[model samples]
Every structure is written in structure tokens, then in C-alpha cells.
Target: MAANSPEGATPRESRSWTLRLRRAIDQHLPMGHLLPDRQPYYVGSWVYVFGVITIAALAWVIVSGVVLSFMGPQWWHDSRLGRFVNSLHFWSVQLFFIFMVLHLWGQYFMAGWRHGRAATWMIGVVIFAVSILTAFTGYLTQQNFDAQFIAINAKDAMNSAGIGAFFNVLNFGQMYGLHVMLLPIGITFLVVAHIVMVRARGVVKPIDAEGARS
Candidate 1:
């Protein structure tokens, strides 16, 4: 037995990378903080619920978008059931933006970035920007005259900005790939990170009544 090894422990077990990774996770994000039974009293406010509502709306958007993708463009543009699902996807995206804006404004007013939460706030801002691009790509993928008009205008704008080479707005395959795959994955990852940071740091406290008046 090696002197550094624990009693009856194998050398590989004592030097396992998985054990080190687990320790790092536990140190940074303990289960207790990750899933607390109770939150701050201020969390009971109606404003706090907007973030959760935004997340729920995003869930619907992803689900409907997946269904639309599997059904393909012809069915979604022609068939009644496919149109219904496409409508669901469209409306859910609207709701997502609506609630996300509400949540963003609510957080801004509350100074949500205070107390080491600046990273969390910044992550949310990135999510918002990425979502805008995702929505724009979705518009470009519509396969209609409207899509063509938007794409032409967007191409002009991109060319003006010197990014048309990389981001060709007229390419339906590129837009569809981004709208359906890359952007969603980025948004989901950012949202998960935002939530984890929020859970780890706990909710921001309500502003003092006196401070508001001042």
C-alpha cells in the first residue's frame, strides 16, 4: 500500500479525476444551495415570477419548433395541423420575448446584478441578444414572399456592416440551421447557467422602501 493512499484504497481510486471534479462541483455548487427548500421572503413578489414564466414560454417554443422541423416546411405551410403547430411555435416565441422583457426590466429596477451577480445579469443580456438573432433567422426561414423581402433587406444591412460574407441572410439552409439548432442550444445553455448562478447566489432582496422614495 502506498503511504498517500487511504486504507484499502486502490491507487487509481485515490487519484481519480472524477473524484476531483465532484469535489470541485460540491465546493462551488453544493446541493443545498442548488435546491434550497426556501428562498428569500422577497421572492414571494409577483415580479419574481416573470422569469419563470419566460422559461416556460421558451419550453413551448422549443417543443413546437422541434415538431415543425420534423414535419418539414411543406406540411407546416399547407396542412391544417401543421399550421396549428407552427402557430403555436410563433406565439410561444412572442410570449417568450414578452415575459423575458418583463423579467429583464424587473431585474434592472431591482438591481439584480448587486452582490456578485453581475455575471448572471450579463449572461441574461447575452441570451436576449442571441434570441433576437434566432428570431430573425426564423423569419428568414419562413419560405414565403415575406421571408424574401426581409432577407433582401437584411442582406443589405449585413453587407453594410461587412458581415454578409459570413452571415448571408438569403441562405435558407444557413438560416434554418441556425434557427433550429445552434441558437436554441446557445440560449438553453445560457439559461441553464443563469438559473444555476441564481440558485447559487440566491434571489436579490427587495429595495428598501425608504431607498425607493429617495
Candidate 2:
């Protein structure tokens, strides 16, 4: 049959990720508005620096978390090296959230969401909330009695609110996967997307004329 017609054309193959991404941009970015030649007028010294620092803190959290996770919960609690590494991971998490909050607050103080950017800001806020919830879940995933005790206590709070009937924080399998994989993936993607939007739009100007100029 003509050499099987070159494997039946292989269904013409789907578009690549880059091509698909470009197509999506073309669809949504309004053409020329996708990029601007002129620099953003409001970028005063270190106006955009917090975004970079926040991202780096997030990176540290993920890298250290991955290494610590491999040490296993038993190793983490039992061995000195594992404990130190685990502690580093924990503190990095704290720093990640701290930096993220500061970064968002800085943007807010500058009124950075004024120019058709509210949707992006909302996404960033949601990511922040999710990250906090994920951190709580991380504490619940420790497998130690402390995790169980905290889970039970929180379950009481959640039960009073009527949600614990659905979610069992004591479920280590679910909590671990959600904390390590799901939340990290969601947070990282949202952070990266938020950053891309910020870069494309530039930091917002200050309200006062002199501040904007500076």
C-alpha cells in the first residue's frame, strides 16, 4: 500500500509548546501592544527588585524541599544532617512567603495594578493564599504525632466551619502530594506568569509627580 503511506501521515503532529504559546499570545495580546519599545516610565531604582528576590526565595524553597524530601521523614526527624537540611527547607519556605507578601505589598503601595492589570494582580493574590494553605498542609504532612495533633485541632476548626467533613488533613498521602507537587506547581506557574505580566507591563508609577519622575 505504497509503503503504508509513510505511517499514515502520523496525524500531522500537534503544534509544539512554543508554537502553541505564540499562538495564544497572538490571540490575546492585541498585536502591537504585546511589547513596547519605550521603557516603562515608572521604574525607579529597585522598583522591580522585589519580584526577583521573591522568585529566588521560591526557588530556594523548592530546591531545598526536594533534597529534604528525599531524606525521608524518618531521616529528617532522626538524623542531624537531615534535620538541618529539613530546617533549612522549612525556613526557606517561611522566607518565600515573607518575600512574596512584601513583594505584593510593595506593588500595591505603588498602585501597580491600575492599567488593565487587576486580573494579573488577582491571580497573584490567589497564588499567595494558596501558598499559605499549602504551608499549613506541609506542617500536617510531617507524619509525626505533632502533625496528627495539629491536624486534629485544625479539623475541629474546619468542622466548626463545616469543611472538615470533606477534607481529612490526617491523610498523609493526599497532604504530601498536594503540598509537594500540586501547590508548588500552582504557585510556581502563577508566580512565573505574574512575573511575565509585570515585565511586559512594567512597574506602575507613583501617584506624586516627583515620585514618578524618580
Candidate 3:
């Protein structure tokens, strides 16, 4: 049987699709690059920490938001524990934005789009934009007077943009659905893509260093 079969060929090697996929992944995102133990010397700078901090804040946001989702709005407003969790979610979001902005500006100043990493920069921008929309929908789903005021104003803005027919800010169900589901998923996916691209291309070299080298 061994002689009849191709010599030195394992069962896994016989699967062409799997082999092709493995080869493609290795070529594009090798394990060493994806999860490196070491990085460029410049990566030791404090600015590089901002991106990790932003991701940490986002983790807290997601955890607290999950709890709030399960308990609902009324519980969050009335119950002590729910209120605490709500505060956690709110503060986490604040921190997430703060660190994300810091990271974004840090990268911008460093010309993060350099070294063929434009896609990484663009994905980060998209994540920021999507996060703003997610936060807006979250505010509209608050089910309070403040929410009402925001919805009313936002309705006018959407109407002015000629998208009110499709995206009614006054609709609680729609806003809540987007806040808890769609927008979060979009942001998460974009963030993952951004990280992957960063790993694939490696961090951009310092502008001064590149200039000196050139």
C-alpha cells in the first residue's frame, strides 16, 4: 500500500485545497509575524502603547455593555448594581475614545500609512467613524428626555441629509438594535482587520530614522 501510494506523502499532503490555504496564509501572515516575540526598537516608545490601551478599554466596554444589555435600560436606571455596570460601560467607552484618539494622532504624526500600510491606517479611520455612529445610536436608545432631545435633533440632521426615510433616529427599536448589535460587530471586525494588517506589514519605521537611512 505504501509503495502504491506516493512516497513520503502524508494524508494531509494529499488535500490540495488545505495545502493551498496553508501556503497562502504562510505567505501572507506567517506565524512569526502575526505573533512576534520581538519588535523594532522604535516600538518601545510610549506612543506604541496607546493602541494596546485602546484595545484594553474596548474590552472593558464590551464586557460592561454585555451586562447592561442583559439587564435592560430600566434595571440600569433603577438597580444599584445595574447602575454601576452602566457607569463601567460609559467610562470604558470614554477611555476607549481617549486612548484611540491618542493612538490615532500618534500614528498620524509618525506617518503610519508609510511602508505600504495605508490599508491599516484606513481601517483604523473606519473604526473611528463606525464607533462614533455606534455611540450616537447608543445615546438615542437611552429612553429618556435626553434621548428624546438627541433623537429630535438627529432626525432633523438625517432629514437634511435625505436619509431620514431609511434611518429614523426617533425609532427606539432600530437605534437600540444598531447600538447593541450591528455597529459593535462592524467596529470589532474592522479593529481585527487593522491589527492583522499591522502585524502583516510590521510597524512603520520612525520618520527621522527613515530619513537618515535614505
Would you list the C-alpha lDDT of every candidate in the order shown?
A: 0.87, 0.73, 0.86
Stretches of model 2 off by over 4 angstroms after superposition: 1-42, 208-214
Which tens-of-lDDT digit does each residue in 1-214 have in candidate 2?
0112222223343235555455555544434544656655656557467777878888888887888777665788888888888888888888887778887888788777776678678878898898888889899988778898999889888788887777777678878888888888888888777766765555565565454232
Off by over 4 Å in 1: 1-17, 208-214
Better of 2 and 3 by lDDT: 3
lDDT of 1 by residue, 1-214 (tens): 0122234446676587676556556655799989889885657779889999999999999999999999876688889899899999999999999999999999999999976789999999999999999999999999999899999988988999998999999999989988899999999999999998898778866654333322
Ranking by TM-score: 3, 1, 2
List candidate 3 stretches off by more than 4 Å.
1-17, 208-214
The TM-scores of all predictions, comma-separated, are 0.87, 0.76, 0.88
Cα lDDT of model 2 overall?
0.73
lDDT (10s digit) by residue, model 3, range 144-208: 89999999988988999898999999999998988998999998998888898888778888775
- Model 1 deviation from the true structure expressed as Cα RMSD, one decimal place: 6.5
How many pairs collide in each candidate, listed in order? 0, 0, 0
Q: What are the per-model C-alpha RMSD values against the true structure?
A: 6.5, 9.2, 6.5
